[model samples]
Structure formats: structure tokens, C-alpha cells
Target chain A: MADTSHGAAPGAESAPGMPQLDFSTFPNQIFWLVVTLVILYLILSRVALPRIATVLAERQGAIQRDLDKAEELKRTAQDAEDAYNKALADARSQASEIVAEAKADIQKDLDKAIAKADAEIAAKAAESEKAIQAIRDSAAKSVAEVAQTATADIVNAVMPNAADAKSIKAAVTARLKG
Target chain B: MATEEAGNGFNIHPMDQFEIKSLFGGGPIEWYSFTNATLWMGFAILAVVLLLVVGTRKRAIVPSRSQSVAEMMYGFIHKMIEDVAGKEGLKFFPYIFTLFIFILVSNFLGLLPTSFTTTSHIAVTAMLAMAVFVAVTVLGFYKNGMKFLGLFWVSSAPLALRPILAVIELISYFVRPVSHSIRLAGNVMAGHAVIKVFAGFAGALGVWAALPILSITAVYGLEVLVAGIQAYVFTILTCVYLNDALHPSH
Candidate 1:
């Protein structure tokens, strides 16, 4: 009676090595196992997995969005660079055109100046030649008249002879003719 | 969780220690106590739930530290599901994730001092294993309906050996739960018992006890690792089970 109350107490020896299998205690554990599994399933199906999946998809979407933004920025940068290059090209062409135009205009103005100077030089030279010839003739005539008058006056005073004066006049006429 | 003289008349038994109980049908069954093991499972599950929930509550655009951790866990599961269950079979993700978490929690819980490891109980493990069994069988039915019956018959086997193969398959199917449950429960139960026995030395040796402490500490660390590893084993087995269900030809 005492051994029975204690359960596995005295005189309960089995064959020394082998352990006995007890078939009686599984009902409650099995019951709870099902219960817990069912409850866990509910929690997972309803809550955890769905939320986890949502977060995962959100992260995927975030990464995707960032990549898309990066691509867009890259495209935009490329476009900006292209536009800048084109603008620079345009500016360079425009500057070249302006420089060419300036060169042509200057060349035209320079040719016109050269032509005007040539015409002015030609006119001046023609006028100067005629004036120089007239001045030379007039000065020569004035010199001859002054010389004749002085010579006549000197001869008349010194010789006081018509013959002397005639001789002087004849000599002057001969020198002049020579 | 106290049983008051359990049952009356033919079914009467004491509540102090673990015992086996018979099920509705005629077969042997055992009942286990929650004493240390069950307590551990509770704490571990609470820890897991708290981690995922509290860790992932805030959704930041550029995720906070917790969010990233949550995201990593989510990604791992997603990939595992995709790889093991395949893309189309991901509908079972919830069940798989739950199994993983619960087992993981239970295993980890078993490692703690003064905690009951529910997973160490064969009855509990058998129930989990049975769930997988039922789920896979149901999945087979769902995917193929009547055609899934072909899973039992090895048409490729020699005609002479076909009957033997069918019997083999049936027995193997019945054995699945046993193997599944025993693998987990045995590892945990044995591990903890060893630890406890080793820890018994410190009391026996008394006062002069550097050796026992060092030994117990080693066992403790090993148990901790085993806790995590056993959880992983359970999870992977679940995957393989899911795989078997999803693709019945194997």
C-alpha cells in the first residue's frame, strides 16, 4: 500500500537495463499542442506574416523608387550636360560670326580709306604742280624786271651817257638771251 | 495548471509527476509536465513576439534600426518561402512562419533556467509534427485532388515490387510524425537533463567546487546554442515538409 501510493517506490524493479514505456500521459499535452499550434497559426496568418510581407514589399518598393530616382537624375544630368555643350557651341559660333563680321567690316572700311587717300593724294599733287609752275614763272619775271630797272638806273648815274647805257642794255640783252 | 486528482473511478491518477494518457482511439500515449519546459516556452514566445512587434511598430521612410531588423527577418522568410515553397506555393507563408517562430521560441525558452521547455515534451512535439503531416496531406489534396493519391504508388517501380512499395510508403507516412517529434524533443529533453545532472554536482561537492561550476557553465552555453540550433532544425524540417507537400512527386 505504501509503495503503490508513492508510485515507482519499492519492489517496482523492471529488468535492470530496459526502460518502460508509459502510454497514459499524452492526452493533455496533445491537446495543448493542438491548441497552441492553432493559436500560433491564427496569429501568423492574421498578423505576423502579413505584416512582415508588407514590410518586405515596402522595402522592395523603396529600393525600387530610389533606383528610379537615381536613373531620372542621371538622365537629367546627361540632358543638362548636352544642353550646356550645345549652348557653349552656340556661343562659340556666335562669337566667331561676330569676329568674322567685324573683320569684314574693318577690311571694307580699310579699303575705302585707302581709295579715298589715293584720290586725295592725286588731286593734291595735280594742284601743287600747276601752282608751283605759275609761282616759278611769276618770280622769274619779277626778278628780271627788278634787275633791268636797277641796271638802267646805275648806268645812267655813273656814265651819264646814252652810249654807255645802250652798251649796258645790249650786254644785258645778250646775257639774258644766253 | 494543477490537476485535482485528474479523473475519478477508472481514470484517477495523481498530478505531481509526468504520466502518459490514452487518446480516444486505442493506442499508447504519454503526458508530460510543463514544470520547467513549459515555462521556458512561454517566456521565449513572449520574447519573440515582443521583438517582432515592438521592434517593427514604427515604419520609417528611411527605416529606423528596428525596422531594418524587421525587414531583414521578413526578407529571410520571403526568400526561404520562395526558394523552398516556390513562388506559387507562398500562400502557406503564414503557417510556416508561425511554426518557425513557435518552435524557435520554445527551443530558446528551453535554454533558460527554471523554465519549462514544452518542446521537450514528446506529446507537444508530436502534435506539431502531426500538424505538418496534416497540412502537407491537405496541401497534396488541394493541389492535385484525386490525382495526389498517385504519390503513394511508385509507378516507376518494378510491377512485381509495387505492392511492397505502397506498404513502405504508408509506413513511412505514419512514421513522419514520430521522427519529427522525437528528433526535437529528444535533443532538448536529453540536453537539459544532462545539464541538470551536471549541475547536481555543485551541491554534492559543496564548498570545494570550481570544477562543477566550470562544467555547468559549459553545459549552459552548449544548451543555449542547441536551443537556437534546434529551432533552426525544426524550421528547416518544416520547409522540407512544405516542399514535400507542394511537390508530391519527390
Candidate 2:
């Protein structure tokens, strides 16, 4: 390859033995390389790096905030549940108190009604006893009257001249006593 | 020259693609001559701006697909520097990131057909490696003072073997930039050159071109992997070197 290149192009040839070994192009490559590196470094440090750092930090902060909000909401829900349970317990105790008060009132009313009925029954029994005593007394009196009359009639029929109302009455009364 | 031999026999000029020609017209390449190298470097810059700047313009908390991609790249390099170079090295994050994005974009761009691979040139890789080397050395002295020399001295070895170990360490330390620069250039150049050679075979071989085409396809896939891996390797090595400068204990 060297002999062929030498025989073909004599001096100031375009293609060398190896293009990489070409000293003439080194300055240009190095110059552009330095320029490129400087440009890249400036852009990266100034604009790109800081921007990415900020974005990453912002994402992290946003995630943290979301988690904190979730925790707060959970705590609020728990507080509400506790309050509801407390209210439920309070209402139950109040209902039981109302029921006890109603039971006491009904018991008082029942006792009063029973006492009044007993008093009425006792008064009616006393009145009936008194009337019964009065009827018995009337019946005894009539019996005595009838007996006296019968005896007097009998005597008058037997002995007409000796029959007197006062005498007969006295005799019948003495015989009855004996 | 290979074009001159095309009429006679098989024509294969794999190195021709690497030639640095003036973009405007044919002339002696001045230091400021806008060549293909300048144009491709400009493309790399445009790619960086589009991805890191325009893509992240929304700055969405829940990132869009392109925005997420940009963030992922940022996080990957950020974490890498933190892990390898320690927290103090985060100060150089933009510098290291610039190197990484440039090399990465340039490698992928070079994989395109008829594109000139800027990183395949020693001139470009050497500048990158030397920049890292000089910066790291200066940082080592600035941070550690004269104690930076302790990085070469093997305190763990036997008393008698310390000198030999120190000499070896010194030599290895000096060779870092050379190996660093050459490794990237060599890998990129080798892959592109191999594909070009295979492509040349596919062109020359009349009826049996299928075999070379198959080889080209397989190699093309490998080259894609190499493109990403080489950029990663370069960045990670830079971090490791920076770590040595920052710590310099061993």
C-alpha cells in the first residue's frame, strides 16, 4: 500500500499512508474540539444542569406534599369516626333515661287509679249493709202485729160474752212470754 | 489510490472515510478551517441541546417520555460520579457529563452510513484524555498537596519492594492518558473499519455477496453495543481517575 501510494501521488497528496497520522489536520480537529467542549460545558452548567436539578427537586417535593395531604385527610376521617361513635353512645343513654322516666310516671298513675277504685267499693258495701238492717226490722214488726190479731179473733169466736180486746191482748202477750 | 486500482482489481479503501476534508471546498486545512470534524461536532452539540434543553422545556413533574429519558441520563451520570468519585467529585459533574454526552453522541452518529467518526481519530480522543489527565493531576496536587505522591508509593508492600512498586505505579499512572485515549479511538476505528471491509467484500463478490452481508449485519449489531459501552467505559474511567485524584490514599 505504501509503494502503491508513493508511485501514484508524488508530492502534496490528498490521501496519506493513514489519514489518522495526518499532522496537518490535527490543529483543526483540536481547535474545534476545544470549542465544542467549552460550548457544551457552558450550556450544561448554566442552563441544562440547574434545570434538571430543579425539576427533580420539585418532583420530590410534590410527592412529599401529596403524602402529607393524604395523611392529614386520614386523620380527619378518623376524628369524624370518633365523634360519630361518641354521639351514638350519648343518644343511647338519653333514650334509656327517657324510657325510665315514662315507666315511673305510668306506675304512679296505676297506683292512684287502684286506690280510688278500692275506696268506691268500700263505700258501696257499707250502704248495702245499712239498708239490709232496716228491712229486717220492718219484717219483725209486721210478724208481731199479725200474731196478736189472730189470737184475738180466736178468743172472740170461742167465748163471745167474755171476749175483750184489752183482756185478750194481755193474755196473748203473757202466753207468748211464757 | 484505491479508486485508481478499481478498474484493475478489487477496490477497498477502508481508511478513506477517516480523511479530514474541508467542508466548503478543497484547500489546506487551517486551524480554523470548518471541516467535517467541525460539522459533526456541531451535530453533537445540537443533539445535546435538543435532548437536555428542548426535551426538558416542559419540566413536568411527571415527565414525558423524552423528558424521562433526559432525567434518566442525568441520574445515571450523577449517581455514577457519586459512587465512583465520591461526593466531592460532584463539583465536576457538568464537565464529566459534557465528555460523556459528546462521546456517546459522536459514537452513535459515526455508526450511520457514510458518516465520519470524529472520536475514531486520535486527535480528538487524545485531547479528551489529556484534558482529564491534566485536570486530575492538577486536582490531586491542589487537594492533597505534596501528599498526592503517596498514590504511587505502595505502603502495603514489603519495605524492600516499595521502590519497585512505586516505579511501576508511576509508569502506570503516566500511561493512563495514552491508554485511555487509544482505547476509545482504537475500538471505534476497528469496528467501523471492519464493517467497511465487509461492505467492500459484499460489493466485490458477485454471486456470494450474501456471506459478507451477513457478517456486516452481525458486526453492525456489535458496533451498536460497542458504541454505548465505549462511552460508558470512557466516562467511568474518567471518574476512576478523578477518584484517584480526590482520595489518592492508595
Candidate 3:
């Protein structure tokens, strides 16, 4: 190390008016300080600053991208919620319509069955009336024939206006007795 | 209190006397002579160089103990700069950290027996301080241009107070190196002188004097603390000056 002894550092020591500026003496100290400063400035402005700025920029950009993705996911979730609600509404209306349709179909089927039963009953009643009418006519004709015969017999026997109604009377009595 | 009493009583050199010397060579090139203070500076530089060289040689994500210790120191200083001066202002971190480490190492190294205290010498401290002063002034103007001189006369002054304020500001600004250098040198020199005096007292104690030794031990601890603090103050002040340069209105 270079001796800086005779030039004792002035502070609490050293007399006033001693030469303060001696470039010839402390050249190396000054030189080293300058070198340090220049090198530090270069490193800061060039190498370190650029790398740090880039890292920070990339970090911020990544954050922004993530935010965009999150926003998109949120929108998709909102859409899904809306669709779910809409589907639920559709299901509710469809269920009620289906219930109403079933009721209407049942009513239609009942009306049709009632109409068919009425037509069948009317046809069967008309056939029964016709059979009863034919039976009544046959019964009336038989009664009339019996009365006519009886009257004829009575006339012939009693008046005897012609050859013996006695034979006819006997026939009638026999008929009656047998 | 005990340490102070011991320190006050013992004196290798009279407390009132201040002596400065340059040993080994003399004459025209006397400034090139080897010095006790320069030895301290050398020790400081050696510590910094060794630390950086060994610390960085085996860089790892999950660091080994030595590397981690180095990283912790780096991180600590980095955070200090970022916290005090913005990350935008962090362009000055390396220099700030270097200044701090060098000063701190020098102060601590000086505490050893048969060692020198470089910062106690005004020329060394003054040179460091002058460099900071020059850098601050130049950087203020360079970064902000001629308008940077407004740091003295502008901002919070009333129109009438401008001249007076300018005078005061100039005086204060010029005094920056003086106060900075004086504060460091004075503290170290005064503390070392006190410790030497107390150490002498310990030797004078007779067979029945265990108390002086204990007090000497206590002064040693306090001196260690002061050494670290003085270095810290010097470094932080440098950063503060840099901050003012970066943001002159501040």
C-alpha cells in the first residue's frame, strides 16, 4: 500500500491553510471512486434496469390475461344460470299443459262413450216396442174370431129359420162341453 | 453508567490532546505512504471482496448457509433501498449497499486491538462525503437540469423570503460534506480514545480490582454498538442525499 503518512488526514488535527487540493497526491483514490461510479451507473442503466423492467412487464401482462380469463368464465357462468332458469320455466309451463291436455282427453273419451250408450239404448227400445205391437194385434184377432163363431151358432139354433139349427146347437154345445 | 465512569478515568493519551500522523515515508510523495487508517480501509475492502466473491461463486435458489447469509444481507440492503428510495430509484442500490458494507466493515474492523480507524480520519471520511456531495449536486442537475437549483430557492418560501432562504440553503448545502464527514470522524475518534483510556485503567487496577475489568468489558460492548450505528448513519445519510437528488423538491 502507498504511504499517505506525512500527509496526515486533516480533521481535529492539521493546521489551518494547509494545501487542500493536491491532485498529484490522491490520484488513485479519485481514480478508483470514478471507476466505481461509472461502472455502477452503467450496470444500473443498462443491464439491471432492462431485465427488471421486462420481468415486471411480463408479470403485469400475465395478470391482465388471467383477469380476462376470469371475466370470460364469469360470463359463461352467468349464461349457464340464465339457461337453467329458462329451461326451468319451460318445464313448468309444459308440465301444466300436459296436465290440462290429459284432462281434456279424458273428458272427450267420456262424452264419446255416453253418446254411443244412448244410441244403443234407443235402438234396443225401438225393437222391443215393435215385438210388443205384433203380439197385441195377434191377441186381438183371436178374440174377434171366437166371438163371431159363437154368434153364428146362437142365431141358427134359436130361430130355426132354416133346416135345424139343432144340429148346429148340438155342435156348439159339444164344442163347449169338450 | 459503569462503562462511562471507566472510560472517563483512563487515558493513554490525554483526553484534550488530538494528534494526527502519517507514518513510513515523508516528503513530496508522503501521501503514498502506508497508514493505520489505510490498513483499516484495506481490511474493509478485503471483507467486502471476500464476501461477494465467496457468496456468489455458488449461487443457488435454495441457498447453503453461507450463501443464505449473504443473500440475507443483500436482501436486507435491497429492501432498505427500495423502502427508502423507490424501486424506480433503486438504480442506486448497488452503490448504496457497497458504501454501507464498506463503512460498516471499516468501523467494526477498527474496534480490534492493534487496528486503525479509517473513518476517524477526516480526510478519508471527507473524501467519501465529498464524493456523495458532488454526485448529489451533479446528479440533481443532470436528472432535472439547470432547474434543479430551484431546490434551494423554490417551493415553500414566501416571495419576500427568497433571498434569505437562498443564502441559508446555499450554506446548508455547502455544509453537507462538513457535517457528514465530521460526524463520522468525531464519533469514531472520540469513542476509540475513550476505549483506550478505559483499557489503560484496567491495567492500573491492583489485585483487588475486578470492577474496572467488568466496566472495561461493558465499554467494549457499547463501542461495538456505536461502531455499527455510525456506519449505518453514514450509509443512510448517503441514501438520503441520493433521494434528495432524485427528487429535489423533497
Candidate 4:
């Protein structure tokens, strides 16, 4: 009994090949494990995990917000461009309209100037015809007077007793008429 | 075995490092005694706190490197929980996050020479697994009441086979915790053990020890991957279990 007990005691006291199989230290191992694990869990849930989650959340929120802002800004830029293009188109149309109006105005002024020039030319032509007619009438009267004087003078010189002044003048006038 | 001799003047004790003793010199370990496990766990917690709290103290919009790392870890697990278990599962984010970070930091720390691998112990992993199992089970019951048992009832199966399918499902349901815990502990322990064995060989075959040493380096790199992957697997599984608990129809 003594030898068996001694053998058993040594077997029990000496460590097992696998320390895990040794029941003696299981409690200590488990106890610390629990303690440390509890502490870690607390830290995780309360401190570590929350901090990480917050950072991640903040990053995501910031990214999404920035993206939305960028989208809004992009839309604004597009709208601005559209507005600019519209304004440009409006300005271009207005400019074209103004050009058309100016062209019409210039054409109207040119036509008026042309009409005034034509009237001036027509009036000058009428005046010029009157001056020519006046000259022609003066020449015809002078010619009639010259022919009577000449006829009277010629009859008196060449045929002294042939005819009287009145007869001669009448003869000359008839001949000129003929 | 503590040490082995391979027909030469070399002695190796690959398993000695796993021994649990009082961190404050050797003595009988009481139930509440501080140990290497506790020390490493404390370190793991400190690492987590430092990364999560202090690193993000400034909370700069343009984060610093440490803050980026903290945020990356935060987002990684956050997305994972949401992806695997949906938005409702985010309610358990703290618990799952704690498990993941603790396991992850512990695994990486374990890679350090002479450092204790807290997760390599069945006790530690089993504790985590049981906690998940119990939480999910309670949540399942609370959410679905007796309908939670419908998880094991195969309605699509033939009428004659439904009961057998239900039994199988029930068995698997109960086996979740066992498999969950063993998967982590076994993988961690095996990797560490293999490294230790190679180390032992390197010491035994002094001149030709370069081969084992090179292998240890390779396995160490693999262990780093395993560490991260195991942590991910654990958290994802937790999320899956939470999913089933929340919706226990199938």
C-alpha cells in the first residue's frame, strides 16, 4: 500500500507530458483567462471598438458628404455654364437683331439720299431747259428785227424809187415767213 | 518525454518547456497562483491594449502606422463577423474580438524562443471553446426556444431516415466544442512539438545539425502562418456558431 501510494503521489506531483492534460493548473489558467478576457471585452466594447467605429463612421460620413457637396457643386457649375451659354446666345441674337436693324436703317438712309439726289438732278434739268428756251426765244426775236432792218436798208439803197418803207418792210416780212 | 538520447552523447528534452510551474520560483501551484500562462496572457492583454487604446489615442483622420494597424485589425474582425453572421452578430463583436486578438497575440508571442504558448494548452483552448458553445447554446435557446432543437432535426431527409439524421446531427452538435478546442490546441502543440523535435535532432547531430536547423526555420515560418490562420479560423467558427444560434432552422 505504501509503495503504491508513493508511486501514485509521484505520478500526480510530476507534471504530465501535456501540461494541458494536467488538471492541477486548469483553474489558474481559466481564472486569468476570464479576468483578462473580461477586461479586453470591456475595453473593446466601451473604448476600442467605439473609437474605431466612430473613426470609420466619420470617414464615411465625410466622404459621402463631400461627394454630395461635390455633386451639388458640379451641378451648380453645369447650371452656370448653361446660364452663360444662354446669355451668350441671347447676346448673340440681340447683336444679330441690332445688326439687322442697323442695316435696315442704313439702307433707308441710303435710299433717301438717292431720292434727294434724283430730285436735285431733275430740278437742275428743268432749270437748264428753261434757260435754253429763253436764249432761243431772244435769238428768234433778234433775228426777226435784223431781217426787217436789212430789207429796208437794201431796198432804199438799191431801188431808190422802187418802193416805200412800209411796202418794203411788208415784202421783207413775207419773204422771211415764206 | 523530457529528454531522449539518440545513440550518441546528445541529450534532448523537447517537452520540458511545456511544464507549468509557478512564475515566482518552483512551488506547489495553487488554484489562484500566477504562472507563466498568466504572465503570457497578461502580456497578450497588454499588447492588445497598447495596440487598440494607446495606438489610437490621437485618432488622427490620417492615421499613423500604429493606428492604421489597430484600425486594420478592427475592420478585419468587424467585416468578418458581419460577413459570416450578418449584422446581428455584430452584437457579439466584443467577445469575438477579444478571443481573436488574445489568441492571435498569444500565438505570435509563443513563436518567440523560450516563450510559453498559452494557446497550446487544451485547458485554455477548451475554456474558450466552452465559453463559445455555452454562449451560443444559450443564445440559441433564448432566440428560438425549443425550436433550437430543430437544428438537429432534418426535415428534408426521408421520413424513415429523419430520426437517424437527427441523431447524427445531435452528435455533431455536441462535438462542436470538442472539435473546436482540439483543433486549435492540437495544431499549436503539434507545430511546436515538431520544431522541438527538429531542435533535438540538430543538437544530437552536431556537424550535420544544419539540416534540422534549416527545417526549424522553415517550420517556424509555417507556425507564423498557422498562428494567424488559427486565430482567424477560431473567430470565424465562433461567428458561424453564432449564426446558427441566431437562426436555428436548418
RMSD of each: 8.5, 5.3, 10.3, 4.3
DockQ for candidate 4, please give it. 0.53
Residue ranges of candidate 1 with Cα displaced over 4 Å: A1-25, A127-178, B1-41, B62-67, B152-170, B204-208
The lDDT per prediction is 0.68, 0.90, 0.65, 0.87
lDDT per residue as tens, model 1, B106-196: 7776566765577777767777888888888888888878777677788889988988998998798878888988888888777777766
True contacts kept of each: 0.36, 0.78, 0.03, 0.72
lDDT of 4 by residue, A1-178 (tens): 2332332325555532555677778888889889888988888889988998888788888889999999999999999999999999999999999999999999999999999999999999999999999999899778878988887788778987787878777876788689
Please compute DockQ, using alpha carbons, for every candidate against the native two-chain complex. Answer: 0.17, 0.53, 0.04, 0.53
For candidate 3, write residues B1-250 as lDDT tens digits.
2345457664344232222234456433344455343445656666655555454444444456655555556566667777766675677776676666666777788788767665666666788899889988899899989777887885687888888988898899999999998898788877777776666666667763467667767877988988888877887788778777887772
TM-score of 2: 0.82
Give the Cα error of residue A160 in candidate 3, in Å.
Answer: 68
Q: What DockQ class does candidate 3 belong to?
A: incorrect
Lowest summed lDDT across 10 adjacent residues in model 1 chain A is found at A14-23
Better of 2 and 3 by TM-score: 2
Interface RMSD of predicted model 3:
7.9
Clashing pairs in 4: B2-B13
Docking class of 4: medium
Clashes of each: 19, 0, 9, 1
